[model samples]
Target: MAGAGGSSWVPWYEHASPVLYLEQLLGNVLKEVDMPLEERDAKLKFADRLQSLTQKAILKEYPNTHTNVALRGFGSFASGFALKGSDMDMVLMINGPDKEKLNFKDIANALKQSFKADGLGVYIISNTRVPIIKICEKPPAWFWEEQEKLETQAAVEASAFKAGDGKNVVGDGANNSETSHSMTNAGVSGEHSSESEAEDEEEKEARLRRKRVTEMANKTNAPKNSKVWYRERKLGKSDFPKSDAGILCDINMDNPMGLENTHLLRCYAACDVRVHPMATFVKAWASRRKINSSRDGTLSSYGYVLMVIHFLVHIIQPPVLPNLQHPQDWPGLQDLLHDEQSQFFADAINGHWIHYVRNVDALNYYGSKNISPNTMPVGRLLTEFFSYYGDPISGGHSWQGHVISLRTRHGGVLDKGEMGWNRATSEMVNGIEVRQRYLLAIEDPFETNHNVGRTVTNEGAGVMRREFKRAVSILRGMIGRGTPREDLMEEWVDKVVVDEGGQGEGNVGRGPVATDGPLSITASLARIGM
Candidate 1:
């Protein structure tokens, strides 16, 4: 019931519905992200600010223009309402056929200056990278679900999942079968199968699961009798949407597997807000460029950390050799070619896992410290991977060679932060209008490792993934039915693994030493005396 659901509005500009009219109120809506309490009056007063900020962003870029750009949807989390925290997220779109390059970053930057605040993000068409900006004044808290509830004014809307009959192929069973016969009102059909089922079985199961999840999206009686609408049926599901690569956040938060990392990222977008550039950057890059529109940059696509895990788990861990001496491994090239896990890794990492991790992590996770260049971000991950592959000290690295790794990494750059180059106006910052460097320091598992302007920190990101997965699993299992709503980061932080010495620094040796560099598989083996 909450969310755009299936109601595709034809942009206000398309219909020219001038229903509500009175006085044009305007100002920064995020002025109260830090505010503790916000009443209705306070929220109504902020609505004008939302209109002004959005309008100013448009006007500053498109001056003397009557051609209104039809807005399709607000940036994720449906920004464009008086959130409980007193913030407003607005979606600005142009529905015309002219595909001229629209720079969302520039517009976002301008808005930061005009509003004299921070914490603003702008995403374009869900295709291009969205830019986040902050406005002056204290604001309140807001979530993506709440936005759908208030804006659509419906408990449930048609799911994009069900909308995928022709374009989207939802298999019949948990294996994702093509022709699914089983049908459940909840949409969950078919019996559970073995995890080691054949491809056909997997496909069948996957399809049924997809439909079931979508059907379940509409029903909301699982929690305290509270109903929540769900969308993005086929897109996928996880604690963190696509990437879902969580580690340990900060040990201080507790629960080594997952705890506080997710909390910090979603907590306050007021004074400090940083995104994992890789997540947002690659997403915007693909969207702006219109690449892989079906799944976009999912874990199977752009999740940097998970990609690394796959390579280690498949290729190097149990390296597919010319012969499987023990019979358990993929012995011949033919077997390797058909290996499911290997294929998954290939589809995810694209052959050279080293090249993929090195380049993407350099940008996404920040590789400038511990043992590599300050210019790149994936500093520690590369060393770990190389070492894992028995080739850490090898100097033969460049982020080139493989095409899959190359394109994925090259696509990781955000052209200089997630800001739009053109089509952006209005600016503001920190309660005063000024310019400041966009720092991508925090780590958020939900975002790309490359995205720097996220609210979650690196420690938090690793743990957030673990927590998100745990939360989803725990809540689902506890009630014997799935409920999308789960605990926040703060709750988990209180239960982190104190043994890791907080921040999950379990003697990893402050990360890698500068002495470590690129080497060969043999050299790595020699060093480890393997």
Candidate 2:
């Protein structure tokens, strides 16, 4: 498929091939939509600060307590796949007897009080299934005042520098400099006549006055620093209903499985160069199709990540990644250790489940291997991933029909019998009763009994499969015979512009999707077919 350019050179499928078009498409989409590095860094830094402040709050609440308080993140932030403005998920670990004595409700109350005392925004969602304190920091009055002062000083300095160069900053005659100075601060450039200058000044004054009024009204209506303040003032405090010390709390701080899973996913990313890009693209794609939230009866981002890892480990020929938890060929001869799977996740506490991954062993084994035989272009892998998950309606296997397990390190189908995942069996996972739905079985790498895909409904799964086929159709068109890549890209732009807000039912608060119908991509490919 050579273009107008002259060449004795044929396209190399892996390197200098037509697949490069797909690569560029994915890269450009990611660059335009994904979170920037600076934003990610700033969010991470803020998370760190929040964590530190939370720990200090706990210590302040209990000065003489010997309990060990540790705050660890567990969501997209910890997993390194965070998008722009993703919420932070943190687990406050209270080890020692304090965990038993100080319940989640108590901790939530203490945290709320402490955060509010510092004027930080805090919402304690203790009534939910998982109690969590959502925190955000707003600029205090002094902070905004300081920023305004800095901006004014910089603007004055710039005006003075211009004046020293012997140029009159033109504006209204008497208030010319003043108007020009204000205009400069507002990032307006050009000379203004006297009448226009007066109008601008009046508008600016009105805006400032309105802003001050709004600030004053907000301050007047602000909540008291603590509940005790209302009590001290005797301001309707007697009529207020009293809350129990630890009522309606749902968070399980003692459990570390969620945090450990985040670590495992991060380790997978660290061990493989392709994992991050591939996972990110898939997550973004799922978001675009509106199938990334478990709360809405679809798979979570983590579930999609597990699927990518499974494909890399088992589905692809020669396997791009080796199974880190595989118990094959003992590297360090701890002679006592016989079985691999059992030994890896056998840790527990007080009959409660605990998982500890041998990160060092996993990294050393998989990171060092040369998988050149398995190496494929990222574009092809992405294409195959969509095709595999979104096989046509006359399907051999779809995400809804079959389970994707990373535990199946060896290439083949894994039956439900092997893993013992079904409705008949039930187990207490981190203090919650978990039963296998067999709907979209994704075995938790560490907590093997837990099904991360239990949230995926039949409808959600169907939507995801259809979207997969749709993506395959789109990509195939771009690489199809006699189709110019630029023409296809232009079509993509046009399609997005036209279909901006009209994405079909069950699609709201999600990334973009195409309303285009599916065509035959799997039938056309000769070398590989899902």
Each model's lDDT comes to 0.25, 0.50
* All-Cα superposition RMSD per candidate: 29.0, 20.7
lDDT of 2 by residue, 288-309 (tens): 5566655344667778888898
TM-score of each: 0.23, 0.60
| lDDT winner | 2
Predicted candidate 1 versus true structure: per-residue lDDT over 1-530, tens digit per residue = 23387776442211211111000000121231222244444543554555566567667776755545432222212211112232222334443333244555565555545543333221111111233232323322332343334224311222444565342222223412212211111110001101001222333344354345334432422212111111112321111122222110100000111111112212211101112222222222222222211111111112232223223223232221111112233222233334443332111111212111111222222212221112222222222233332221232211111111212211212232233321212233222221111212211222223221211222322332332234233323323232224321121101101111123211211221222112212211111000
Deviation from truth (RMSD, Å), model 2: 20.7
Supply candidate 1's per-residue lDDT for 157: 21
Model 1 misplacement above 4 A: 1-45, 64-66, 69-83, 97-105, 117-130, 139-530
Q: Which ten residues in a row are the worst by lDDT in model 2? A: 226-235
Candidate 1: residue 308 Cα off by (Å): 28
What TM-score does candidate 1 get on C-alpha atoms? 0.23
